[model samples]
Target: MLRGQRLGCLSIRKGGSVDTHVEAVLAELAALEDPRMRQVNERHGDDHGVNLTKLRGVAKARGTDHDLALRLWATDDTAARLVAILISRPKSFEASELDSMIREARAVKVHDWLVNYVVKKGPHAEELRVAWLDDPDPVVASAGWALTADVVAKRPELVDLPGLLRTIDAEMKAAPDREQWEMNSTLAAIGIHHPALRPQAIEIGERLEVLKDYPTPPGCTSPFAPIWIGEIVRRQSAG
Candidate 1:
């Protein structure tokens, strides 16, 4: 049977029951898949074929539905999980549950959305951040750095800027791609937000040369930390 036809066969019933809603959403997502979108997303290591804008529309229509979100996440479908993150109540998740979810979220977009939408807003963000920082798995460790970067950007007083720069100097160049990206982000965040440490952050970025030659499209900013830091600081000064 064709994939769409098979998905069409899912029993989507009316009313507010969790199973009914999940099946309905899955059906909606299956219908929204585009081959062109899949090709583009695959280039970025995301497996979903649904356009993110359309997926956000689906989530908007559903509003917040934590029970449905859990059911959708359990489906383990990338699009469904994205919708699940959209509809979830971040505070509703337990620390252990969030940790398990992050570890299981293998799709790049799924992991990204889960961290940005649910994990960051959850109360256990700091707890998970510290636990995952030195995790054996590089991907999990990347998430730890992502959370740490957020803290560095928003709550500088809570983190040790010099220590983070030292870690980035020591570890970023050799770290795996995902972890390295987040560590670089922390480096940029420190330089962008903390003038006192900006010089050291730029020095570390210059010394490492990570993403230095990254091909950035014309209008977008480069991910190289020194350039990223300089551009943002310039913008802040202009504003």
Candidate 2:
């Protein structure tokens, strides 16, 4: 029998062990950490080296257990927290639940993963996105931008394109690093998806010089909005 362990406001029991299931998963994750992957992950500042494909397998084996997820998140292990996000119920975060997680989301991977795995799919996603846009916390604000960008990409007509363009024009260079990436991508999305705004987006791209000099990877479209838009426009014209 394993010893009892409980996070505030939540409890678990498995084979007479408190959170034993969570512990079991953690043990598995600890064994899977690869040194090379750890080195790469550390460079990215995420502090976890477990292969993602294997991690998913772990979640699959354990099945969906929000109780385990929450307890794993409460621990300090980076990989465990990632697994927590992976295993947790997609829309189970209650009011203020996200706020608590955001506080500890110091790593970029953690911030991005939580947003992708939890926040964007939740009922409060749109509300939280708009509200978090102006939040003081960089991570929250970054997440807000990311969520908005994704929505804008898929459904440009629903967002205030002009306002977003304005922000991209005015603040992207000065915004936080993650926020800049999101804003840049949003500008590209506008150019790619909204023909009427393509010129404006390209112009903004020119002014910002965002990715102007970025070396495009072989066979990959350049991330620079102007170049990316030009290529797409050329392809469309040819077609």
Candidate 3:
């Protein structure tokens, strides 16, 4: 059990028994628990954890604590779940399990980690992603777009740039906030990697004006697609 505002007193170890590793990780996280973070995490509906930075340190220690990670995820502790995503072996998951995780996920962090770290890197990423695009679940759909954005950025050869460009043009404004964000990224990726589609991407950005009104912190790129796409294209050109 967790001590008041402290992580559970479990003892985890790198390369140790899974039980030991889980315990040690929990104990370490418990020691680093921050009350202020818990208040913020609660807003995400059941994220149970300390700060992500500390959880990452725990994952680095284990590197690939598959069994330990599974056990941790079952605990529903926010920090433990994040560690689970980091250390779980991609090959160990079945397709059904991946779908189940998305359906069960209640926090955006879980959705992000599953898409960015787990599914996007899985062997069936493309296969799974294709179907996710049409999934009725918003989390799954958002993840599809997110995974697509990654594919568009790193493996453009695998994507149908023209088709995705059309999809972005059609669905972006009506999409949910998270899905719209990833959709914008897809637009940016298309602009950065596909020369023929770059102008079209810019046109889409101009039309949507998504994130145009959002404030940009000093020294940070604007999240607005027109601005974001411009910076990405500028970097690609400079290189």
Top model number, TM-score: 1
**For candidate 2, lDDT tens digit of each residue in 1-239?**
11123233333455567767666877899899899999998987889889989988987876788877888887757888888888888788763677667657877787888888898778867777777778887666887788887888775656899999998899987887777777787888889778999999999998899777777779988878898888877887899
Candidate 2 lDDT at 164 equals 92
Count: clashes, candidate 1: 0
lDDT for residue 66 in candidate 3, whole number 0-100: 78
The best candidate in terms of lDDT: 1
User: Residues 101-219, candidate 3, lDDT per residue (tens digit)?
Assistant: 66656678877888778887678688777878777766678878888888987887877889998888888988888788888888887887778877888899899888788878899
Each model's total of backbone clashes: 0, 0, 12
Instruction: Report how far residue 208 has shifted in candidate 1, in Å.
Output: 0.6
TM-score of each: 0.91, 0.85, 0.83
lDDT of each: 0.87, 0.79, 0.77
Off by over 4 Å in 3: 1-24, 40-49
Model 1: weakest 10-residue lDDT segment is 1-10
Q: How far out, in Å, is residue 134 in model 2?
A: 0.9
The count of residue-pair clashes in candidate 2 stands at 0
Candidate 1 TM-score to native: 0.91
lDDT of 1 by residue, 1-239 (tens): 00111111222332544466787888898999999999999998888899899999999999999977877877768899899899999999888788778787878989988889998998988988888898888988999999999999898777888998888999999999999999999999999999999999999999999999999999999999999999999999999
